[model samples]
Target: GKTHLASALGYKACQEGIETRFWRVSDLVLELEKAWKENQLERFKKKFNRVQLIILDEMGYVPFNKNGSELLFQLISDWYETKSIIITSNLEFSSWNKVFIDPRLTSALVDRLIHHAHILTFTGESYRLKNALSKIE
Candidate 1:
């Protein structure tokens, strides 16, 4: 459901000719790790300099390794204040350290994300689950 909402926003931004990228947290960190190994991390990050928005989906679904966590923090920090980001995460902020490993990094990441953000909390049965059960019934 969160992914669906973010996708709709991304679609609208694209319709308005805004440059946008949609990346799953796991996939993005893996790509960053690859870029780091290839010694092209800067080049890879630079590609986002012109993009207006980035939508990071399913952030807490996979925990990040040290390299992945650090790389993801760097990637997000790069766009802090300059570009727009929409992150969809099921984990509460208090539980984010479980995914990030480093408490300090997790704190910093949450701080960056929450500042100037319009917080939206979804509370209910998942739409997908509700629909599936209704169909079966």
Candidate 2:
């Protein structure tokens, strides 16, 4: 539902003709890794040059390799203060290091991401869990 709501915002931006990009965090990292291995990282990174907003979903859902961490750091740094980014993460900021391969990179990336960023934290029992319990009761 969170993702759906975020997606609606992205869709509404698209309706207004904003150049937007939506990506799953893991898949985005995989693509970056692929671009690096193919020696086309610059070209791949430039693909976002015309985009105004980027929605990165499901962060912390999987672990990132060193290269993925580096690539993501570089990308986020490039977008810092220049573009809009919305990230949905399952892990708290304090535990981001668990998903990233390098501690220093994680710190730098988190700093860049949180600069002038609006954070909305999800809390309490999961809706699915509540519904399931009610069904059995």
Candidate 3:
């Protein structure tokens, strides 16, 4: 369910007047990298820390180098139990080590997440083509 479930969750939280900002993982990393270069990383991290749910969409889709992997690990560890994180990935949990360069970090990350997480594996053909072909009829 990568179809904006986190955005919907965030929207609901916002309706209750809770602040939320949804961003893709790559976008977030890019923005934070930019912030780091501009010496405003604190501002971006603060925004993330304030969110009730930080949904990282499309994890394990793109492999991160060691540094990026370490940065991600730090973020997750920092937010461990302090804030909720929703991660969406097409890859199975067993193959998560493929994404993160370091095995230890991957193990730690998965361990922390699975302890308080609910895994929901989605099954079906791609909905994109299904919806598009239906419109042609």
Candidate 4:
């Protein structure tokens, strides 16, 4: 549901000629890992730097190893205050350590993300399930 909303916003941004990009957290980490292996990490970072808005979907669905976590942190840090990021995560702020592993790094990442940010929480049954049931009825 949150991913749907975020993607809609990204689409609207694109329609308005704003530079927008969307990536699932796991895929983004994998891309970063590949970039690091190919020694093109800087190029990867530069590619996203100019985006006006980035939607990071499905955070906390997969936990990151230390290296992947650091890479994600670096990406977030780079985008901090420069570009808008809409992150859709099922995990609460307290559970973020489960994903990042390091408490301090998680804290720092949360701090950077929450600064000058608007957070929206969605509660209730899965929208996809609800839609499926409605169609059957």
- Clash list (residue pairs), candidate 2: none
TM-score of each: 0.94, 0.91, 0.83, 0.93
Model 1, range 1-137, lDDT digits (tens) per residue? 89999999999999999999999989999999999999999999989989999999998999989889999998888898999999999988899999999999999999999997987899999988999999999
**Candidate number that wins on TM-score, 2 or 3:** 2
Best by lDDT: 4
Put down candidate 4 lDDT per residue, 1-137, tens digits, no spaces. Answer: 89889999999999999999999999999999999989999999989766999999999999999999999999899898899899999999999999999999999999999999899999999988999999999
In model 1, the runs with Cα more than 4 Å from the true position are: 134-137
For candidate 3, give the lDDT of residue 28.
65
TM-score of 2: 0.91
CA lDDT, every model vs. true structure: 0.94, 0.89, 0.78, 0.94
Q: Which candidate leads in TM-score?
A: 1
In model 3, the runs with Cα more than 4 Å from the true position are 37-39, 132-137
Specify the poorest-scoring 10-residue window by lDDT in model 2. 1-10
Ranking by TM-score: 1, 4, 2, 3
Give the Cα error of residue 68 in candidate 3, in Å: 1.0
Backbone-clash count (model 2): 0
